[model samples]
Target: MNHYRKIGNILESAMKMVLLTGITGFLGGHLAVALLRAGYKVRGSLRTPSRRDATAQAIEAAGGNISNLEFVELDLTKDAGWNEACTGVDYLMHAASPFVTSMPKDKATLINPAVEGTQRALSTARNAGVTRVVLTSSIAAIVPGRGKAGPPHLDASDWSDPDGHVNAYVESKIRAEKRAWDILQPGTTTTELAVINPGFIVGPLLDSDPGTSGALFQRFFRGEVPMAPQLYLHSVDVRDLANMHVAALTAPAASGTRTIASFGAYSIMDMAECLKKAFPAYREKMPKFQAPDWLIRLYALVDADVRANVRELGYNPSLDEAPGRALLGRPPIPITDGYIATAQSLIERNLV
Candidate 1:
């Protein structure tokens, strides 16, 4: 057998366990399904026992076998059940992190949980002798830009400036990812680390609670914003992002590497135009015009969410996906398909 297939057979024969965090969240839910389908015994962690049933149902609904999937109660902040959760697990997928568009009253509300939780996860994984950890980091961690024009392109080598005009969410992701790497330095531990830095994730939801990015479609289809804001984003389908997570687990060159999983840089206006084409019935609700920069700045004065996005207004950073694409062995799902899938899920769930 080839090297990759050899690892697969060993894992299958040994029933290698994988400890996955944030299985109740969007990306985590998909990761659970992917891992389960890959023949790995997945042990997922959640903050409460109440969410276990919902997560299991979501996995089952996604066509994942829950017989090989189990759940453990664990919190990022508290030291309750983390160590026990990592026990016997050979791989770790740290997909848990606070994601929000609104600025919290206190920045640490987001920062503490992310940083502390990453430390807790890595520290426990190291002590448990876990082989590798695939950390779900965001592109936000690599690039925090001001609204002003800057770099022409961003890649794995870049790092977000903490002092930049980024929101609490961006800051938290940067710190959490940095701490994770810090804990697993070359000589410090044998636990390997591979980080997947994906852009805005949007695709079909495996459950009712579509994440922050998925909810954008609901707003788009409801005419929540009559005009598209002057903001640019790089998006990746959740399915594609989940596949990158799985590929990172066994790729020979993935260790100690940060793979950027963004596909294309699209403006809000571009996204709305695509939505109009895909779902003509919602044409009236789709944004018909781009809100001028001055008007958006004016609204930011009174609106907290708009204020949080001000630094991103008219900001579209260049991204090169060659490295990330190489890891997937193909181009990511098209941005148009991402929008359609998210729209379909929202409609099916009666969310729109």
Candidate 2:
């Protein structure tokens, strides 16, 4: 199929309208800002309309033009306003999914909302005849459950084994992404699908609230984490991830493709070292040593977050950044910059 031609047609249209779900979220807020800055009319989805003003203010504070931004109430678990929200939309950016750091007793708490939400968004977009949909997936969908013996070099083609010994979040992401592809399969719908699978995202926060990624730095700054875990994180700046989502809208090559938006991988201690150098004031609070694997296991016994991700200890895999770099048309933003930005944002917002 000539994907380029489809995108060309989209560009020819004037002032496309994009329906962005999860606009109140961390990555979603960035995506909304990027979309608005790119001159698209964005109707941001919110579960509660009360957040409209704050969300708009946050986007505006982030240097986005919110003059063209509007809000609609929609919930991932409910179908009340989906059709009305999707009507006349040119594109759909589905970024609303349940995210939790700890493992849930009932996996369905995360899995059901994620998978069902994808279904609601994509199916509604198709019915509305939306041209293309940009879905926010995660590297979690591609990287986990491959086992220690799996391929060392991971890319878009990699799929996490949902049935394997993976966490609920990983399983949810894997299932949700698969459901998206299943719903938007070739020759089935006019809405072309493009996915952005990002890694551990970190960057400046648009609001005082620090989402999951930002909370990591919040904990670090508050001296909550005394020892760094032995986990390696594939990092990406939220700003770059947001830009990639905007780029995917008309990048014909992105259609029907999963783009890995990661700069590189760094260990937890590595991040600590970077932060220590950047913020000397927090030097005493920052983790000075990597926790032993055995100690981490024991800590997991009482820490739900640690227990949920205990399997990730020493589980770093190589990632191919060529596809993401090609999409960006340049090198990714430095991880160091992201680290600093996150720290500064936390301090400025008094989140720490």
Candidate 3:
């Protein structure tokens, strides 16, 4: 009878468990569903417990298994719940970093949480004996410091200069990712670290909250943006980015490194063209004319959002995603598909 009970316990605990941070956010919500669909028990950490029911309903509506999903209240700025959150967790995916386009009145509002949150989370996860941590970084950490005069291509080998002339969002990502590596690089922690540096993420959202990237598309389709800027950015499907996070869990080759997950850089006009070709309804709404550099600079003087893009205006960024793609065992979802899905989801939700 004792032996049978032991066997029963073994069978019950066959599935692995993953502790995911920022599970209420757009990417985090998608990651939770994907992990559940792949048969892992997901214990998601959010700042507020009130969002659990809504998040669960959204995941369920998107065809995720809610039976194995659970939530705990945790915030990036505070250190109280991390130990409890990491307890008994097999994998840790830290996806909760503050992202914004406008430079805040105080930069530490973004920088402190991101760097300290990663440090706190990683330290706690290591203490709890979590095996691996996959941090959701961004291309912002890699793309800066590449002046227009420099090489056209960048890969995981590069790092963004935190001291460079970049907005608070880019600086926060740079500092946060560096802090993560500083913890893991010098054998400071037993836990392995893998980072996913995704570009402008655009794809179908499970909930009405289409993230910052989706907000850009929303403006485009709503005709809020009359003239597209000369900025170009590498776009990745949210689903593909989530997949890379899951794959990083056990991929031995993925340990102690960063992966750039993107289809390629598409200019505003280029993405608008893609939208126009895919959805006839957006043909007129999407900006066909690219704003000249001088006009963009003048607009930036008054618009905080466009001011953020001043550094990259007319600069096309090219990235090497082959390494990241190989790790996922699949190619990235096409750029056009990402845009179409993003638009369709927004339209369905009446956000556009």
Query: Distance from true position, residue 303, model 3, in Å?
Result: 2.8
Q: lDDT for each of the candidates?
A: 0.86, 0.88, 0.84
Models, CA RMSD each = 2.2, 3.2, 5.1
Give, for candidate 2, the lowest lDDT window spanning 10 residues.
1-10
Model 3 lDDT tens row, 1-352: 6456435434543588999999998899889977876668999997888888999999999878999999998988887888888878988999999887567889999899899999999888878888889999999998865555556778899888889877888999999999888887747778899899998888898889878888888888888778887878888888888878877887778898899988767888888888888888778888969989899899889888677668777666578878888876766788788888998998899998
- What is the lDDT, from 0 to 100, of the residue 262 in candidate 2? 92
Off by over 4 Å in 3: 1-14
lDDT per residue for candidate 2 within 269-311, as digits (tens), equals 8998999999999989988799999999998899876787777
RMSD of 1: 2.2
Pairs in clash, predicted candidate 3: none
Lowest lDDT block of 10, candidate 3? 5-14
Error of 1 at 203 (Å): 1.1
Model 3: how far residue 3 lies from native, Å: 34
What's model 1's overall lDDT?
0.86
Is candidate 2 or 3 superior in lDDT? 2
